[model samples]
Target chain A: MERMDLEALNNELLDAVLEKGSLSFVVNRLHQALNKGVLICDCLGRILIGSNSEIEYDIDAYIAKAIDHSEAYYYDQEICQLFFPIGWGKLIAIIIVREVKEEEIENILPVLETANLSLCFYFSKYNAIREVENKYKDLFIQDLLFNNILENEEILAKSKLWGWDFKKEYFVAVIEPDNFINIKTFAEELEYITKKLAKENDIEIITSVRSGTFIVISREKNNQKERVKEMIVEKISRANKYFSEKYDTTFSIGVGHTYLAYKEIYKSYQEAKTALAIARLIGETKFVKYFGTLGIFKLLYKQEAYLLKEYYYETLHKLIEFDKNNNGELLPTLDALISNNMDIKLTAEALFIHVNTLRYRIRKIEEILRIDLSKLENVVNLFVALKIKALLKLHYSDID
Target chain B: MGYGFLFNIDACIGCQACAAACAKKNDFFLGFRRVQKYELKYRGKNVVFYYSNSCNHCENPECLRRCPERLYFKRRDGIVIHKMGECRACLTCLKACPYQAPKFNHQIGKVSKCNLCVDETGDPLQPKCVKACPTFALQLVHEDYYQPMAQYYHLPIDTIGKSHITQPSIKIIIPPELQKNGEN
Candidate 1:
């Protein structure tokens, strides 16, 4: 070969090394060194990549069939190679034991090393670029999303992001695992399931961000929030059952309602997460949806009198005393009052208690307190009072 | 009882600074570790995180029980240390560690575990992992006090107790919410 021709070939090889820098590049470089007849086999004598089309071997098979000695081995009118790769184990990449001289194998090893080194350089350069880009992106997002940190009132006031379209709804769901140690495969599985569900629904899920929580932004009308919530509850239930059966541990899900602005998004996320905690406290299995159903707690928190007055605590205390006095009827009445928002029929159906019994309990409480519980506004007040009472006890108990 | 390290999983950003520091601190040959970060998934989100792993210096060290040469020894402070010179390269101790604490050194032809940097001159009584953890994910706590410290915050009391292997005195103080959410 002419000197110019060899130089041109070198340049081409160098270009290949720089551009397609990976295992394939090493294979190509080795092929060039071996006059394109080299076969790369794993330790198991299975041909990894090769020029020989007829050779058949798996990783384990390659280990079994490859010649033990360094010398070339020919069997059944075919040539093969075998050698172990460094920094790995017995069942790793294949070695080619072919009709090659000692000088040829030694010469090709350097070329293969050079190709691998060149590839490593390329990867490092790519990784450096990636690292800078990721750092900038993370910084940008953190500044954009959380610039309004606590006590940064002036910064928060100046931060003018557009209001989210209230027409579109969002939900925050946190996936927490008990032992989040060395479980990357499980995360991939979850992402797969979420993507699949979103695709099947034909809904363009906005804000499908993954942080501590997998916050999915879905479009929901005010009327459709219930339906969407139910769907999520069902999905989580199914997933938990499947996971539990497979892993023998219950997986908890904390789901928050969608908000209009990014600011409210964090609150919703926290609320959903807190709801998950409450669910666990109650020993509810599988999943917990926040803000959608808090039973009596929802109404209790919703009422103004409960927020402003301390009457609820007193009312609950009295009811507890009555219950201890062998009166189990008042507790159900209190639950009914809150569940139905002081409505008799709804409360009766919700508790599965008799409406007459509910009426009698309310009348008895009215007589005890010297207040007319029959009045609509008074009934509402009493319901709120009971919730405040229960909440205080729970909060104090938790503190202790 | 020996005090061990704690990993705050929430604070661990998975930078691998601790792992690199561990490798450098121990002068670890290929694949050996005094400490390293671990990760897991929660719900469906990629909660990218890490934790420091090391010898728990168990109440009952599996490595000690399984050591053929009986080279593994427990100190008064709950550290499980070994003399590399005495090891016969028999890998039974590696198999016995539930946490996989001990690593084989092919170059030295002996087994190695985190020495708590005791051999190093003028060193504080701390492992390379705790000293190097940028996010304070790893900390060498006094064994007796760490349990009550965790229990004070309503966290689980029996982390190492449930393992039933060598009762390594080390424990992790993760976000209380994390265990409630999804921690196995």
Candidate 2:
């Protein structure tokens, strides 16, 4: 074949492949252009598009043989097959040609090679386009979650175009992989797996990965919030198991409350974020933490940091200062007193100190602070102050 | 006094053929020309308006000013073109442009925008969008010809940054009813 003729053929093949048409239409065009009966099959050897219906060929066996040898296979003059693997062993599809003459083999081989190359190029292009589209979708979801999309009507219309049911009530759940090295790849894999799981379970969920966290905005059709919470917990638990077994990575899920309206969904996202922070702080054993269960911590967390710091200083500053100056054990004693429910014997046992020493520490704490530990109001105040200090410590230690 | 796009908002049917053609010509998977359809309740009637826009190639382009990498350059013919390989994808250009012309391509980790189909336009052909508009709503016209129509269309003489800071080169021809109702 002349160089000009080959170049023309190559251009024609690429034009056919790149044309904005269906895959079947492209394959049919290729068959007509090459003057050969063509059969296109997936990696599993299931015929997707074929020109010759009367021709009997064992395509599965041929594909297996071709893949094993990593080359094209020619079975007499009747049938020839080429395997087109896209992106490192991912066999996109196979092209099987029928009725080739001996003299036309050289010319036909280059055409088949061109067709295979074009298919690979087309598939990669298609995937690249799909990925870019998904990124735009991710941006939209991110904007919605962060309340950056303030125009509710515009968002509702855009969501309809994106095929998302904004009318459905939703709660946000954030999934984070423990000790992930490649967060971007892991997040993509997590989204894929979560999407597959959602399909299998017949759940309507919108998911996106942002800043290494996989976020799922799941629809809640049930009127009862408890049932919806139960359903989410069950789904997350199953997903956690699947991920742990398959990827060897444990995931922690933070679920927010279900809101009735789409406009209020950002509040759910905020709740989910707080749930994750509180779960990490309280040493939660379970992988899933719902915002509702966070209880008093949620209210306490909403207070201004300066107010909490002031309260902490006012209640425990003397004790802390005395401990710093004399290396006294009053703070530990107070903690033990609170944990043991103000039972002196139990507090002494828990602290691994003699009863006499415990009594002496308690006297010093009471005398230094000028507060009677026997009074229920003073005990309650000290207990609340200690809890606030612990919560503040957790807040400060966590890196946002 | 160079070439610019003239959008006949009255003639557009919101078909988005221009957007499709622009995407195909540029091989843009996403971004490029965006056809935004919005509805407004005016005079007790809901009216839908379509805005098909790409880069205006402004006479004083904000993208040229804010690009930290100096990726944008204006030709002698008043066409703003971005240097493809030099983009660091910092996204300052996206924020700077009031029209939001520069789009960040996540796949390539860079920003891309319409260059007025410079290669084809330099061949003395219309931009792809102008050529592909079935309703002939998009036209490539010289700035001298656009100024008169700009008055009729009530094209804003200023935008967010300052008074006529960017001096966008494009012209908009809004529908008569919309203009009377004072809808933007």
Candidate 3:
């Protein structure tokens, strides 16, 4: 908007290659130049970069108006915030300035324009780097997951070229987004933020996107098993929370067992995918599940879902039918019994019934299924069948 | 209903061997599976991609709705079975499919599409085209309604056809080298 401001922005452009690589630094420089808080929000109004005070602002409602170039300011008594959209065509990533006066707009517009130019430059640079990085990383991940590398030595050599250490014990984590929301955009942001946070935490990580799920391979620095699990859970859950809050979407994380050999990373990746599938099947969206802890589910998930459903019906249909016919609570009683390890007292207490009543229900279940609950094999069968019933019921919409 | 095909765009060579395999296995005059090619401009560079498509076996099938006789139906595993004997050759399916999946056979005076090799392996379901791909470019992917957007890995529907209308159950992986993250 001014000749002098244009010269100043041009001067900064030449020195940009010397500054630390980040968009926030540019936004911070703009904040210092203007003496007002500034932020760059994506189309969804999620603050991608903020400088000075990281204040939470409920600006989502005005995003459409800001993008449409309708009203540049959301006014209270006067202009409290100014919006300058930064993109092409329907392009609307807003630059919102806090507490900027309308009188100062004549002078501020030029500086804002310079900020917009700097943002574009940074974005273009990021795209250039990401394009080349993603190209090779995708190929490397494909080789790791699908193509057999022939020998551990081969992967060790390849890892060295990628600036990753295959010698470190690595655990593969697969995160699947639970809903639709500008996914490619989210994936880019996720890659940037995850890497940044990992670096800050001093955790070594290599990330790649394949088939829409984010595949993250991070080194296990801790020797204690519990500490490693805790650290990973903490790191991933924190990242998940940030994305869920920012993007209005949830992600399911599945972690596989740690592997010592470079070649075995593929196995861990497969196991993580399996774990993610089971987490989806059982509706365990709240936790980061490990494949080793899945127990019987690990085996059951490998089977065809329809076959599992069929087995569920064959094993428990009689009890279900009886319950429907008589309005009995036998099914719940059996579940409680199996869950309690056939402890008559605990089952009775859980069901809020007498011990005699629990015994009566157990006998009825055994007779109906034609198996003795005292036998471990029969109990195992009932347990597996009940688990299958739970799994299928949660996901019955797929079949119907 | 969640069963679908995942096509790897980068891996495909556009050989049309999948089309031939579909025709041979099903004994039909027209192959149910066909591969479509797209040449697109990404970041000011031309990139050509091949998409091997078949009956998407959508959750809400157009043939099942448009056919006055309701000859087309989806099974539990999401395969759209065109009951060969029941079709009166109304040709509604041929007109309804967005992907042009169904073919009208003048010789048989009926319509047919992919059975997904369901009759081959009944429980798990299989596709002859997937098995025929030498590059392993195609595989079956399953999903639950509650799960995340697993199919978003596919090429955007606008890049190929109006896929959102039928909500086709196919995931076509975008070639990895293009780097489409920027708005350019």
lDDT of 2 by residue, A61-117 (tens): 666776776455454543543344333467777676666666766666666665666
Q: Give the TM-score between model 2's chain B and the true chain B.
A: 0.83
lDDT of 3 by residue, A343-388 (tens): 9999899999999988888889989989987888988898898887
RMSD of 2: 22.2
Specify the highest-TM-score model's number: 3
Model 3: native contacts recovered, as a fraction: 0.00
**Candidate 2's DockQ:** 0.01
Clashes of 3: 0
What DockQ does each listed candidate score?
Answer: 0.01, 0.01, 0.02
What would you estimate as the lDDT of candidate 3? Answer: 0.70
Give the runs in model 1 whose Cα sits over 4 Å from its true position: A1-189, A204-214, A217-310, A326-328, A340-359, A397-400, B1-184
What TM-score results for chain B when candidate 1 is compared with the true chain B?
Answer: 0.79
User: Can you give the lDDT of residue A40 in candidate 1?
Assistant: 56
Candidate with the greatest DockQ versus the true structure: 3
Cα RMSD of all models vs. native, in order, equals: 22.3, 22.2, 16.5
Name model 2 segments beyond 4 Å from true: A1-126, A148-153, A177-180, A222-226, A237-251, A277-287, A302-306, A313-383, A394-400, B1-184
